[model samples]
Target: MGKVVVVGDRYTVSLFKLIGTEGLVLDDPLNLETTLIKLKKREDIDLILVANDLYNPVKEKVESLVIEQKKPLVTVIPTPFSQGQPLDVKGLILRALGFG
Candidate 1:
Protein backbone atom coordinates (compact mmCIF):
# COMPACT_ATOMS: atom_id res chain seq x y z
CA MET A 1 0.00 0.00 0.00
CA GLY A 2 2.87 2.35 0.74
CA LYS A 3 6.22 2.93 -0.95
CA VAL A 4 9.45 1.07 -0.08
CA VAL A 5 12.59 3.06 0.60
CA VAL A 6 16.28 2.49 1.19
CA VAL A 7 18.76 4.38 3.34
CA GLY A 8 22.46 3.64 3.19
CA ASP A 9 25.90 4.73 2.06
CA ARG A 10 26.68 6.13 -1.40
CA TYR A 11 27.62 2.78 -2.92
CA THR A 12 24.60 1.00 -1.50
CA VAL A 13 22.25 3.74 -2.64
CA SER A 14 23.72 3.77 -6.14
CA LEU A 15 23.44 0.01 -6.50
CA PHE A 16 19.78 -0.09 -5.47
CA LYS A 17 18.95 3.02 -7.48
CA LEU A 18 20.35 1.30 -10.56
CA ILE A 19 17.75 -1.38 -9.96
CA GLY A 20 15.05 1.31 -9.61
CA THR A 21 14.73 1.35 -5.84
CA GLU A 22 13.91 4.75 -4.28
CA GLY A 23 16.02 5.85 -1.28
CA LEU A 24 18.27 8.37 0.43
CA VAL A 25 22.06 8.01 0.48
CA LEU A 26 23.51 9.27 3.71
CA ASP A 27 26.84 11.02 3.22
CA ASP A 28 27.55 11.34 6.92
CA PRO A 29 26.90 8.95 9.75
CA LEU A 30 26.31 11.90 12.08
CA ASN A 31 23.06 12.60 10.33
CA LEU A 32 21.86 8.99 10.30
CA GLU A 33 19.77 9.30 13.46
CA THR A 34 17.93 12.41 12.39
CA THR A 35 17.38 11.09 8.90
CA LEU A 36 15.94 7.82 10.19
CA ILE A 37 13.67 9.66 12.61
CA LYS A 38 12.27 11.74 9.78
CA LEU A 39 11.74 8.70 7.59
CA LYS A 40 9.89 6.90 10.39
CA LYS A 41 7.25 9.61 10.49
CA ARG A 42 6.35 9.39 6.82
CA GLU A 43 2.92 7.84 6.25
CA ASP A 44 3.81 6.81 2.73
CA ILE A 45 6.73 4.58 3.66
CA ASP A 46 5.87 0.89 4.13
CA LEU A 47 9.38 -0.51 4.31
CA ILE A 48 12.95 0.73 4.79
CA LEU A 49 16.10 -1.12 3.71
CA VAL A 50 19.12 -0.07 5.74
CA ALA A 51 22.69 -1.05 5.01
CA ASN A 52 24.01 -3.54 7.60
CA ASP A 53 26.99 -1.41 8.54
CA LEU A 54 24.91 1.68 8.97
CA TYR A 55 22.20 -0.14 10.84
CA ASN A 56 24.64 -1.50 13.44
CA PRO A 57 25.35 1.97 14.72
CA VAL A 58 21.71 2.85 15.11
CA LYS A 59 20.33 -0.54 16.06
CA GLU A 60 18.82 0.50 19.34
CA LYS A 61 16.96 3.48 17.95
CA VAL A 62 15.75 1.61 14.91
CA GLU A 63 14.59 -1.44 16.84
CA SER A 64 12.69 0.74 19.26
CA LEU A 65 10.76 2.31 16.43
CA VAL A 66 10.11 -1.06 14.85
CA ILE A 67 8.65 -2.38 18.07
CA GLU A 68 6.76 0.70 19.16
CA GLN A 69 5.42 2.25 15.95
CA LYS A 70 5.03 -1.09 14.12
CA LYS A 71 5.00 0.46 10.68
CA PRO A 72 7.56 0.95 7.97
CA LEU A 73 9.28 -2.43 8.37
CA VAL A 74 12.98 -1.72 8.88
CA THR A 75 15.35 -4.37 7.63
CA VAL A 76 19.16 -4.59 7.73
CA ILE A 77 20.69 -5.81 4.49
CA PRO A 78 24.18 -6.91 3.59
CA THR A 79 26.62 -4.49 1.99
CA PRO A 80 28.87 -5.07 -1.03
CA PHE A 81 31.95 -5.84 1.00
CA SER A 82 30.33 -8.34 3.30
CA GLN A 83 30.76 -12.06 2.85
CA GLY A 84 27.91 -13.89 1.15
CA GLN A 85 25.30 -15.28 3.51
CA PRO A 86 21.81 -16.60 3.23
CA LEU A 87 18.99 -14.27 4.17
CA ASP A 88 17.09 -15.26 7.30
CA VAL A 89 13.62 -15.07 5.85
CA LYS A 90 12.14 -16.95 8.79
CA GLY A 91 13.66 -14.56 11.30
CA LEU A 92 12.37 -11.58 9.40
CA ILE A 93 8.91 -13.04 9.31
CA LEU A 94 8.95 -13.59 13.03
CA ARG A 95 10.08 -10.04 13.64
CA ALA A 96 7.42 -8.67 11.36
CA LEU A 97 4.85 -10.66 13.28
CA GLY A 98 6.13 -9.11 16.53
CA PHE A 99 7.40 -12.43 17.82
CA GLY A 100 11.12 -11.68 17.73
Candidate 2:
Protein backbone atom coordinates (compact mmCIF):
# COMPACT_ATOMS: atom_id res chain seq x y z
CA MET A 1 0.00 0.00 0.00
CA GLY A 2 0.93 3.69 -0.22
CA LYS A 3 1.22 6.46 2.30
CA VAL A 4 -2.05 7.45 3.99
CA VAL A 5 -2.61 10.94 5.25
CA VAL A 6 -5.55 11.44 7.64
CA VAL A 7 -6.99 14.92 7.51
CA GLY A 8 -9.23 15.96 10.38
CA ASP A 9 -9.25 16.69 14.11
CA ARG A 10 -7.10 15.02 16.77
CA TYR A 11 -9.59 12.30 17.72
CA THR A 12 -9.75 11.24 14.10
CA VAL A 13 -5.96 10.97 14.11
CA SER A 14 -6.19 8.39 16.88
CA LEU A 15 -8.68 6.34 14.87
CA PHE A 16 -6.36 6.61 11.90
CA LYS A 17 -3.68 4.92 13.95
CA LEU A 18 -6.08 2.05 14.56
CA ILE A 19 -6.60 1.75 10.78
CA GLY A 20 -3.02 0.45 10.54
CA THR A 21 -1.69 2.72 7.87
CA GLU A 22 2.03 2.28 7.33
CA GLY A 23 2.29 5.88 6.23
CA LEU A 24 2.37 9.07 8.21
CA VAL A 25 -0.82 10.61 9.68
CA LEU A 26 -1.03 14.35 9.58
CA ASP A 27 -3.19 16.02 12.27
CA ASP A 28 -4.36 18.95 10.26
CA PRO A 29 -7.41 20.74 11.67
CA LEU A 30 -6.47 24.32 10.95
CA ASN A 31 -3.78 24.58 8.34
CA LEU A 32 -5.53 22.43 5.76
CA GLU A 33 -4.26 24.44 2.80
CA THR A 34 -0.64 24.06 3.83
CA THR A 35 -1.12 20.41 4.66
CA LEU A 36 -2.73 19.75 1.30
CA ILE A 37 -0.05 21.72 -0.46
CA LYS A 38 2.51 19.50 1.19
CA LEU A 39 0.48 16.41 0.39
CA LYS A 40 0.35 17.40 -3.27
CA LYS A 41 4.10 17.68 -3.31
CA ARG A 42 4.56 14.23 -1.81
CA GLU A 43 4.26 11.93 -4.79
CA ASP A 44 4.54 8.97 -2.48
CA ILE A 45 1.20 9.73 -0.83
CA ASP A 46 -1.28 7.41 -2.56
CA LEU A 47 -4.41 7.78 -0.45
CA ILE A 48 -6.20 10.39 1.61
CA LEU A 49 -8.73 9.76 4.42
CA VAL A 50 -10.98 12.67 5.18
CA ALA A 51 -13.03 12.57 8.42
CA ASN A 52 -15.18 15.40 9.57
CA ASP A 53 -18.07 16.13 11.93
CA LEU A 54 -19.97 17.88 9.17
CA TYR A 55 -19.06 18.65 5.59
CA ASN A 56 -15.37 19.07 5.03
CA PRO A 57 -14.60 22.23 3.16
CA VAL A 58 -11.06 21.08 2.57
CA LYS A 59 -12.42 17.99 0.86
CA GLU A 60 -14.19 20.07 -1.75
CA LYS A 61 -11.00 22.00 -2.42
CA VAL A 62 -8.79 18.94 -2.68
CA GLU A 63 -10.98 16.29 -4.35
CA SER A 64 -10.25 17.88 -7.73
CA LEU A 65 -6.62 18.07 -6.84
CA VAL A 66 -6.62 14.39 -5.99
CA ILE A 67 -8.11 13.63 -9.39
CA GLU A 68 -5.72 15.96 -11.17
CA GLN A 69 -2.82 14.44 -9.27
CA LYS A 70 -4.10 10.89 -9.69
CA LYS A 71 -4.47 9.74 -6.10
CA PRO A 72 -7.19 7.75 -4.34
CA LEU A 73 -9.57 9.27 -1.77
CA VAL A 74 -11.48 7.83 1.20
CA THR A 75 -14.14 9.72 3.08
CA VAL A 76 -15.44 8.62 6.47
CA ILE A 77 -17.54 9.71 9.40
CA PRO A 78 -15.61 10.18 12.64
CA THR A 79 -17.70 8.94 15.50
CA PRO A 80 -16.47 10.42 18.75
CA PHE A 81 -16.61 7.22 20.80
CA SER A 82 -16.61 4.41 18.32
CA GLN A 83 -13.01 3.65 17.62
CA GLY A 84 -13.10 -0.13 17.92
CA GLN A 85 -16.41 -0.55 16.12
CA PRO A 86 -16.39 -1.77 12.54
CA LEU A 87 -17.03 0.91 9.97
CA ASP A 88 -19.11 0.14 6.88
CA VAL A 89 -18.42 3.58 5.48
CA LYS A 90 -14.74 2.81 5.62
CA GLY A 91 -15.48 -0.42 3.84
CA LEU A 92 -17.12 1.59 1.09
CA ILE A 93 -13.93 3.55 0.59
CA LEU A 94 -11.76 0.46 0.66
CA ARG A 95 -14.05 -1.25 -1.80
CA ALA A 96 -13.91 1.72 -4.12
CA LEU A 97 -10.12 1.66 -3.94
CA GLY A 98 -10.12 -2.10 -4.55
CA PHE A 99 -8.55 -2.81 -1.20
CA GLY A 100 -11.54 -4.43 0.48
Candidate 3:
Protein backbone atom coordinates (compact mmCIF):
# COMPACT_ATOMS: atom_id res chain seq x y z
CA MET A 1 0.00 0.00 0.00
CA GLY A 2 1.19 3.48 -0.86
CA LYS A 3 0.34 6.95 0.39
CA VAL A 4 -1.84 9.52 -1.34
CA VAL A 5 -0.41 12.92 -2.26
CA VAL A 6 -1.70 16.18 -3.61
CA VAL A 7 0.24 18.76 -5.58
CA GLY A 8 -1.02 22.21 -6.47
CA ASP A 9 -0.85 25.94 -5.79
CA ARG A 10 -0.68 27.46 -2.32
CA TYR A 11 -4.44 27.69 -1.83
CA THR A 12 -5.06 24.12 -2.92
CA VAL A 13 -2.19 22.76 -0.87
CA SER A 14 -3.32 24.66 2.18
CA LEU A 15 -6.87 23.39 1.79
CA PHE A 16 -5.66 19.77 1.58
CA LYS A 17 -3.37 20.25 4.57
CA LEU A 18 -6.26 21.64 6.60
CA ILE A 19 -8.03 18.34 6.02
CA GLY A 20 -4.86 16.49 7.15
CA THR A 21 -3.80 15.40 3.69
CA GLU A 22 -0.18 15.21 2.58
CA GLY A 23 0.61 17.56 -0.30
CA LEU A 24 3.11 19.86 -1.94
CA VAL A 25 2.45 23.53 -2.56
CA LEU A 26 4.08 24.72 -5.75
CA ASP A 27 4.63 28.45 -5.60
CA ASP A 28 6.59 28.70 -8.86
CA PRO A 29 5.82 27.19 -12.22
CA LEU A 30 9.51 26.88 -12.98
CA ASN A 31 9.82 24.20 -10.30
CA LEU A 32 6.87 22.21 -11.60
CA GLU A 33 8.95 19.86 -13.71
CA THR A 34 11.45 19.12 -10.99
CA THR A 35 8.73 18.65 -8.43
CA LEU A 36 6.85 16.23 -10.65
CA ILE A 37 9.99 14.26 -11.40
CA LYS A 38 10.66 13.83 -7.74
CA LEU A 39 7.11 12.75 -7.07
CA LYS A 40 7.22 10.25 -9.92
CA LYS A 41 10.33 8.66 -8.47
CA ARG A 42 8.82 8.24 -5.06
CA GLU A 43 7.74 4.64 -4.49
CA ASP A 44 5.66 5.56 -1.47
CA ILE A 45 3.12 7.63 -3.35
CA ASP A 46 0.27 5.81 -5.11
CA LEU A 47 -2.30 8.50 -5.87
CA ILE A 48 -1.55 12.09 -6.86
CA LEU A 49 -4.24 14.75 -6.92
CA VAL A 50 -3.20 17.74 -9.00
CA ALA A 51 -5.08 21.00 -9.36
CA ASN A 52 -6.62 21.47 -12.83
CA ASP A 53 -4.99 24.87 -13.17
CA LEU A 54 -1.54 23.45 -12.55
CA TYR A 55 -1.98 20.14 -14.38
CA ASN A 56 -2.43 21.70 -17.81
CA PRO A 57 1.10 23.11 -17.87
CA VAL A 58 2.82 19.82 -16.99
CA LYS A 59 0.31 17.42 -18.45
CA GLU A 60 2.64 15.89 -21.03
CA LYS A 61 5.34 15.14 -18.53
CA VAL A 62 2.86 13.68 -16.10
CA GLU A 63 1.35 11.50 -18.79
CA SER A 64 4.73 10.16 -19.77
CA LEU A 65 5.39 9.13 -16.21
CA VAL A 66 2.02 7.45 -16.00
CA ILE A 67 2.61 5.50 -19.18
CA GLU A 68 6.17 4.50 -18.42
CA GLN A 69 6.27 3.92 -14.69
CA LYS A 70 2.59 3.09 -14.10
CA LYS A 71 2.99 3.59 -10.38
CA PRO A 72 1.29 6.74 -9.24
CA LEU A 73 -2.21 7.55 -10.42
CA VAL A 74 -2.55 11.20 -11.28
CA THR A 75 -5.88 12.98 -11.31
CA VAL A 76 -6.82 16.60 -11.94
CA ILE A 77 -9.24 18.29 -9.59
CA PRO A 78 -11.02 21.61 -9.73
CA THR A 79 -9.57 24.36 -7.59
CA PRO A 80 -11.43 25.70 -4.58
CA PHE A 81 -12.16 29.05 -6.22
CA SER A 82 -13.45 27.35 -9.34
CA GLN A 83 -15.56 24.78 -7.48
CA GLY A 84 -18.23 27.32 -6.61
CA GLN A 85 -21.30 25.16 -6.99
CA PRO A 86 -22.41 21.75 -8.13
CA LEU A 87 -24.07 21.45 -11.53
CA ASP A 88 -27.88 21.40 -11.51
CA VAL A 89 -28.68 18.42 -13.72
CA LYS A 90 -32.46 18.81 -13.33
CA GLY A 91 -32.40 22.47 -14.30
CA LEU A 92 -30.22 21.68 -17.30
CA ILE A 93 -32.63 18.99 -18.46
CA LEU A 94 -35.66 21.27 -18.05
CA ARG A 95 -33.95 24.11 -19.93
CA ALA A 96 -33.00 21.73 -22.71
CA LEU A 97 -36.64 20.63 -22.91
CA GLY A 98 -37.87 24.30 -22.95
CA PHE A 99 -39.90 23.66 -19.81
CA GLY A 100 -38.00 25.83 -17.37
Candidate 4:
Protein backbone atom coordinates (compact mmCIF):
# COMPACT_ATOMS: atom_id res chain seq x y z
CA MET A 1 0.00 0.00 0.00
CA GLY A 2 1.06 3.59 -0.50
CA LYS A 3 1.96 5.82 2.45
CA VAL A 4 0.21 8.74 4.11
CA VAL A 5 1.89 12.10 4.52
CA VAL A 6 1.15 15.16 6.60
CA VAL A 7 2.23 18.63 5.49
CA GLY A 8 1.74 21.31 8.09
CA ASP A 9 3.50 23.19 10.84
CA ARG A 10 6.08 21.55 13.10
CA TYR A 11 3.56 20.61 15.74
CA THR A 12 1.22 19.07 13.20
CA VAL A 13 4.05 17.11 11.63
CA SER A 14 5.25 15.95 15.04
CA LEU A 15 1.81 14.78 16.07
CA PHE A 16 1.34 12.60 12.99
CA LYS A 17 4.92 11.36 13.00
CA LEU A 18 4.35 9.78 16.39
CA ILE A 19 1.67 7.60 14.82
CA GLY A 20 4.11 6.37 12.12
CA THR A 21 2.87 8.63 9.34
CA GLU A 22 5.51 10.51 7.40
CA GLY A 23 5.35 14.31 7.63
CA LEU A 24 6.86 17.49 6.28
CA VAL A 25 7.07 20.74 8.21
CA LEU A 26 5.71 23.59 6.13
CA ASP A 27 5.42 26.88 7.97
CA ASP A 28 5.19 29.17 4.97
CA PRO A 29 1.95 29.75 3.12
CA LEU A 30 3.81 30.98 0.07
CA ASN A 31 5.46 27.59 -0.31
CA LEU A 32 2.32 25.57 0.16
CA GLU A 33 1.53 25.20 -3.54
CA THR A 34 4.98 24.09 -4.48
CA THR A 35 5.12 21.70 -1.56
CA LEU A 36 1.82 20.10 -2.48
CA ILE A 37 2.80 19.75 -6.12
CA LYS A 38 5.98 17.95 -5.12
CA LEU A 39 4.06 15.61 -2.87
CA LYS A 40 1.53 14.86 -5.58
CA LYS A 41 4.31 13.73 -7.89
CA ARG A 42 5.46 11.01 -5.52
CA GLU A 43 4.19 7.54 -6.35
CA ASP A 44 4.70 6.37 -2.79
CA ILE A 45 2.34 8.87 -1.27
CA ASP A 46 -1.37 8.07 -1.34
CA LEU A 47 -2.92 10.59 0.97
CA ILE A 48 -1.94 13.97 2.37
CA LEU A 49 -3.48 15.32 5.57
CA VAL A 50 -2.84 19.05 5.81
CA ALA A 51 -3.46 21.19 8.86
CA ASN A 52 -6.41 23.54 8.48
CA ASP A 53 -4.27 26.62 8.93
CA LEU A 54 -2.14 25.85 5.93
CA TYR A 55 -4.87 24.32 3.84
CA ASN A 56 -7.38 27.10 4.18
CA PRO A 57 -5.34 29.56 2.20
CA VAL A 58 -4.92 27.21 -0.73
CA LYS A 59 -8.21 25.41 -0.53
CA GLU A 60 -9.38 26.22 -4.05
CA LYS A 61 -6.15 25.27 -5.73
CA VAL A 62 -5.79 22.10 -3.69
CA GLU A 63 -9.35 20.99 -4.31
CA SER A 64 -9.03 21.50 -8.05
CA LEU A 65 -5.88 19.42 -8.18
CA VAL A 66 -7.34 16.64 -6.05
CA ILE A 67 -10.55 16.47 -8.03
CA GLU A 68 -8.64 16.27 -11.29
CA GLN A 69 -6.64 13.25 -10.19
CA LYS A 70 -7.49 9.90 -8.67
CA LYS A 71 -4.61 9.43 -6.25
CA PRO A 72 -2.87 11.22 -3.46
CA LEU A 73 -6.07 12.47 -1.92
CA VAL A 74 -5.53 15.68 0.01
CA THR A 75 -7.61 16.43 3.07
CA VAL A 76 -7.73 19.28 5.56
CA ILE A 77 -7.56 18.48 9.24
CA PRO A 78 -8.58 20.86 12.00
CA THR A 79 -5.82 22.44 14.02
CA PRO A 80 -5.87 22.71 17.83
CA PHE A 81 -7.37 26.16 17.58
CA SER A 82 -10.28 24.86 15.52
CA GLN A 83 -10.84 21.63 17.40
CA GLY A 84 -13.22 23.04 19.92
CA GLN A 85 -16.06 23.09 17.40
CA PRO A 86 -17.81 19.88 16.55
CA LEU A 87 -17.05 18.43 13.11
CA ASP A 88 -19.75 17.82 10.59
CA VAL A 89 -18.87 14.20 9.94
CA LYS A 90 -21.79 13.66 7.64
CA GLY A 91 -20.94 16.64 5.49
CA LEU A 92 -17.32 15.58 5.32
CA ILE A 93 -18.31 12.11 4.30
CA LEU A 94 -20.66 13.41 1.68
CA ARG A 95 -18.00 15.67 0.24
CA ALA A 96 -15.46 12.90 0.28
CA LEU A 97 -17.84 10.73 -1.66
CA GLY A 98 -18.62 13.57 -4.08
CA PHE A 99 -22.26 13.48 -3.01
CA GLY A 100 -22.32 16.86 -1.36
Q: Top TM-score: which candidate number?
A: 4
lDDT per residue for candidate 2 within 36-85, as digits (tens), equals 56776766666766565422556675556545655645444554644556
Cα RMSD, each candidate: 4.7, 4.5, 9.5, 4.8
lDDT of every predicted structure (CA atoms): 0.71, 0.57, 0.67, 0.75
Model 4 TM-score (2 dp): 0.76
Q: Against the true structure, candidate 4 has what lDDT?
A: 0.75
Ranking by TM-score: 4, 1, 3, 2
Candidate 1 lDDT over 3-82, as tens digits, reads 66778888877876765567798866557678778988999877777777777776776667545656777777887765
Task: Judge candidate 2 against the unseen true structure and give its global Cα lDDT, from 0 to 1.
Answer: 0.57
- Candidate number that wins on TM-score, 2 or 3: 3
Give the total clashing residue pairs for model 3.
Answer: 0
- TM-score per model over all chains: 0.72, 0.59, 0.67, 0.76
Judging by lDDT against the true structure, name the best candidate: 4
Candidate 3 residues lying further than 4 Å off, grouped into runs, are: 60-62, 66-69, 83-100
RMSD in Å for model 1: 4.7
Q: What CA RMSD would candidate 3 show?
A: 9.5
